[model samples]
Target: MDFRTQTSSLDALSGVNADALVLVLAGDTLPVGLDASVAAAAKDAIKLGDFELKAGKTLVLPRVAGLKAPRLVLACAGKASLKSARSAVQSALSALKSGGTVHAALAFAGFDSLSEALVEQTVLAALEVSYVYRHTKPSAPAAPKLAKLSLLLGKDDAKAAKAGLARGQAIGAGIELAREAANRPPNYATPTFLAEQVKALGKSHGLKVEVLDQKAVEKLGMGSFLAVAKGSTEPLRFIVARYEGAAKTVAPVVLVGKGITFDSGGISLKPGAGMDEMKFDMGGAASVLGTLRAVAELKPKLNLVAIIAACENMPAGNAVKPGDVVTSMSGQTIEILNTDAEGRLILCDALSYAERFKPAVVVDVATLTGACVIALGGVRSGMYASDDELAGALLAAGDAALDPCWRMPLDDEYEEGLKSNFADVANVAGREGGSITAAKFLQRFASKYRWAHLDIAGTAWKSGGAKGGTGRPVGLLTHFLLSQVR
Candidate 1:
């Protein structure tokens, strides 16, 4: 579909002359069809509520014979308000999305006026949100469908609005690309493969990128992350992406992502059923990498440090077993009571190591536990934080980005879930209130710095193939980073 801006209602006439839908704002009766008499009759029909036209309502008119009224559709924008106008456009778009087959155009209300940027941003947001991807397991190639979209704005307004849409669409395309990466199969999206993918994205976007292999991970004392990777023949991978768009003196915002590319419950060993979906376990890291790609392209005036602790967690002879104690970079020992509780093990060292970068703030994302999914369901992710102000900022950013998240509790009472007799903490507690305990474990590693943990277990990937790739809260990570700039 070609979603472009049209300057005036007259520009729409040059396009395909099929049945068209022109959304008009209702006010005092307006002329419709070819003759003034015909327009008067149409007005009478509207007065009689034949088409059921009302303020802030949508009325679809059948084929007629006027330049703009032949297939005229009236969508009420109450009293020429900006919000109402935007609502009307969105309603029309929703109508189109829900199966309206018309060359769509929004015929402007000649009396009302709006800024080009506002119009462009509104339309752009609508178009981006309305894009529905159709992907099925049994794939078939077919011809495309045509559902053209046009906005009739003033000449100057059209140019500015289209430019705004162009910019927004570019960023959205990057986001969609990352979402697809997050949706790929486990075998196809291994740690090494993702490392290469991030390297490619970094190079293209003019950001600095580096990857540390298994040997490097061991050398850097990433014991917890390495323990999980020990069972898989596939090399463990750790990636760092840096975006420098501010002055050298500015402190950077750091993003840490748990990239367990494929988790099979390690030595604890997951059940045989539904393990294939572990592919999307790396969604958090993919979102972080995607944010780097977008920030570099958008050239936001900020400094960023993105880290992906990428590895595969499988059950093999070499895998770390239960009751094993491992010392992290922070010199804190953790007892591995259940190897399935491994994401925090990997992320703990990652979060502690981030201290070297001297960041003003740090945020970590992970699909850490099913407990989070049990608590929040699939629509919203669980948010845990050590700082009240940072949590507030994140909540606001999530709302602004339309990547909804709910602040989950991180009470001190849950701290006992991680206490161990010998080590500093145990990997897992009993099944009761598991999500809060897992968060409590990660909180121990984020001392001093303002940090937030996003548990994306529920929102990372859907079970029965949702229409879109990836999920919400993925964008929230990027949105949070962008919000932190000065």
Candidate 2:
């Protein structure tokens, strides 16, 4: 979509002879000048004629008095209520997609002082909602269609607004990358293939990317991450990407993602039911790489790093067995009581290794626990943080991105659930509070820094592809990192 700035009235814009012109009305509104053309001069006693427009409503006006365009779209901007304007914008976008070529003009004449950020967000929402991805499916519903987008600002203060559009496009592209990765069959999106994807993303975005093949990961003592890959012919990979765009003195913000390109549950086999969705086990990695793409394009004044522990867990002669004890790089020993609880196992080593950077903050996102899905359903991801500030920041960032999140507790008592008779901790705690125990397991390695964990099991992939991949934490995480730098 293209966004252009216009500084003219509706009447003056009639000469452009464009496809369509969208007029946005702000407030408890009424639609006026519907039948009139751009060439028609305003009359002193024109009748509004019960054309009262409601807040958060949109009406299409066809062929006004003197304009060459075939139709005129009037969108409502709801009362200057908190976040109501955003809902109004979303509604407008939905309406705009129904019409053919979109060239919109939002003239906020009577609204109270509106922030530039709000405008940017509104515009971003419109263009974003206009897209649909249904190419491969045979019976996919036709997504909404639009060719171009134009925003007629009430004021000529759109200099800061362009960043929002750019960020939105980058984020959308990142989401597509993740969706494509998720859409691929497990045989194709192997550990090696995922590693290559990360490297290509890095090269395109100016990030320094590195892939540690199996030998290198073993050398780093990534026993648990490597163990998951032993059963697959595809080799394991520890992918790292660094973006040093901040001051030399600043420590990087580390993001560790669990990348099980495909999970077969190894010796601790999973039920046959719903195993097909295991392909999305790598959603966390996709999100991390996608956010990196956005951060690279935005180039916020902060150093960023992404560590993805990539592998596939399949039952084979060499696969790590249950009751195996693996020592993480941090010297912590974990008893693998259940092979299915492998995400935390891989993340443990990645988290420990992230400590080498002495980062300002460390956050790890994973499709870690089914318990999280039970707790939050598929709408939101469960957030567990060791620090109050990081947790608060994540919730606030989530609000800004319109992807809401709820904070979950990480009580020290849950650590007891992970107690192991033979090792320092057990990979799988009992059934109770499984999500909290998983968070506590990861918290062990992140005890040194302000850290947060996002268990994205419920939010990564949707049953209805039309809902689109929730693409959850990436938007919130990217916004949070941007806030840190600004």
Candidate 3:
């Protein structure tokens, strides 16, 4: 959608030509800046108990006397805060979905002034509510008609609001790209398919894209990654994409993603129920591509490299079985105690491969463990970092982007759970603290540099009515990368 900033004044509102006007109120009393007739209409509605000043409440007026817009929507934010503003925008947009409105002007009342945080959150919420998945489902309803959005702000806040709109648009596009790839079925979004998507993104953004086939991966001694690909008939692809906005000598921020496109638990098959959701196993890989797209669009003055170990984990005759020991690119041995724990196996080699970039920091994203879902639920992604500084930066970034993550303990004691009887380490530990053990397994290969892991199994997608990819952590990752820009 096209977004721009407009002056939120009485004269400006008089000339504003949109199908609908959204007035975000911070309290019960109307602010002094709204158009006289529009404010009177809203005040009358509140007095008659037609609308309450509760958070996320909405009231629609078919026509306001003096406004150029045909419809007026009064949305309650309850208080002046970024979170409330976002919810108010979302609530207003949700109410307009079935209408014929094509453009909406959003003006905040009773707030101090429009800030970058407010505008950015507003745009992000609009884009998120506008998303509709219709790629595979031909009979799905068409998306909403609302196509253009205007954020009404004062003249002093125009510059900052414009910047926020740009960032929001870039990040929103990235989220859409991630959700599209993740929502596709396994047959349509295979390892090769993902490599093709990366190449396309690279060509458009002037990035250096490389896809390592099975032979090249084997040449690099990625036995651990190859083991996960053995069961699938489709070929495996290791993707490396580079965005160089700075000097080549600069140490780049490396992002490694686990790309198990369709995980069937390999020789250890998962239960039949809800197996279709396994297509979302590549959510980490999707988010990596999404963040790269956003960073490339913004042209941050920092070098970035993305590494994806794309493959499928299936239960076939030649699939890697439990009790098998595999050697990784780092020369570390891992015992396959449970093939379902394959995300870490592929990521170990990918993290080891990231060392060649001489990275300043490496953060690997993966839908790693179900135990993480039980621990943190869907509210936060499970984060495990080697140092406090890196963890704090990520936590702050998540907070700034409204995509939150909680740091989990990584004490040396957790390593004991991953002890192996024969190999250097076991891929799977006991059921207790399964997520921490999974992070500890990946930590073994990231010893060469500062590293962190995001276990996104619980936050990547939803299961019930909203059974689709949420495109999570893309915002968090984009914010984190932008924070590193110099």
Candidate 4:
């Protein structure tokens, strides 16, 4: 979709040329700047009980006497806030989805402040609602015809609006990329396919990309990562991608992603029901690629590296079983107590590999544990960071991007559950604080650098009717990277 800023006075709004005109409202009261005729029409609608000032509520007026557009949409935001603004945009777009509306001009009627955040959220909401996963399902309805979105802002807010629009568009594209990759069926989106996708991204963005096959990973002594791949015929791929916008002397921020392309729980098989959703186990890898695409587009003056341990975990005759022991890239041994707990296994090796970058900070993203979904639900991703400053930056970035994360404790006590009699540590800990224990396991491999772990099991993808990848933490990660720009 195309996004642009338009400066128009309230009196001139009726003359703005577009297929639809969207006005965001805070209450029943009409905005002060609306043209006399437009204000009268809006007031009459409210007086007649046709519209309510509730968040996410929307009403459409068609071909009003003085309006140039064929339709007028009143999107109730309730108040001037980012969340409300996003709802208002989504509601407005939803109202116009069926219509042949090709372009829309969105205006904030009673919003007291027209900030960059408001514009950014508007773009994101529109793109999100506009997205349709048609790759596998050919019969799925095509996305809406809405192609252009104009944010009607005051002249003073134009600069901020432009910046926000650019950022929003970049992030939206990245999100779509992540979602598409994650939504693909495991057959089509195997570890090799993911490596190919990253290679294509590197080619398009002029980044350095490397794909290490099973032999190379074996040579690197990523026994923990290989253990998860041994069950599947699909060869494991260790992907390392570098985006260098800074000099080589600058230490980069490394992102490690758990890329279990299709996790069937291996020998510790999961229940048959809903096992198909395990295709989304690569959500972290997808989000890492998504963030890399966004960063490449923004061209931030900072170096970034992505490490993905891509493979599949299926129950086979040779699959690693409970009580099996394997050494990681860091030379730490792990006891595989539960093959279902495979995300952490691959991530530990990838995190260990990240040390090669001599990174300023390393943040590993993974759909690691179901306990996180029970703890934080889908509202927030679980975050565990050893460094307070890095934790604070990520928290602030999540807030700014509206991809929120709640910091979880990294207390030493959590590590106790991971102790193993046969190995240095156990891959599976007791059920208590499962998410934190997973983070603690990864933390062991990341001791050489400032590190944080994002457990995105709950937030990466929705289930049931809305089942698909969410492209989460990409916004948070992108914002965090941009914040670190020198």
TM-score of 2: 0.87
In Å, residue 169's CA in model 4 sits off its true spot by: 0.6
Task: Please provide, for model 4 over 1-486, each residue's C-alpha lDDT reduced to its tens digit, 9 standing for 90 to 100.
Answer: 888889987778888899999988886567776877578777778789897777777899998888898898988888777887898889899889878999999888777667878888899999998999999898999879999999888879888888898899889989999999999999999999999999999999999999999989899899999999999999999999999999999999998888999999998889999999999999999999999999999999999999888999999999999999999988889999999999999988898888888999999999999999999999999999999999999999999999999999999998999999999999978999999898888889989999999999999999999999999989999999998888
Top-down TM-score ranking: 4, 3, 2, 1
**Candidate achieving higher lDDT, 1 or 2:** 2
Error of 4 at 293 (Å): 0.5
Every candidate's CA RMSD: 5.1, 4.0, 1.2, 1.0
Better of 1 and 2 by TM-score: 2
lDDT for model 2 comes to: 0.75
**RMSD in Å for model 3:** 1.2
Count the clashes in each prediction.
1, 7, 0, 0
Backbone clashes in candidate 2 total 7
TM-score: the better of candidates 2 and 3: 3
If scored against the real structure, what TM-score would every candidate get?
Answer: 0.80, 0.87, 0.98, 0.98
lDDT of 2 by residue, 86-133 (tens): 666666667667656545554443355435556556655664576555
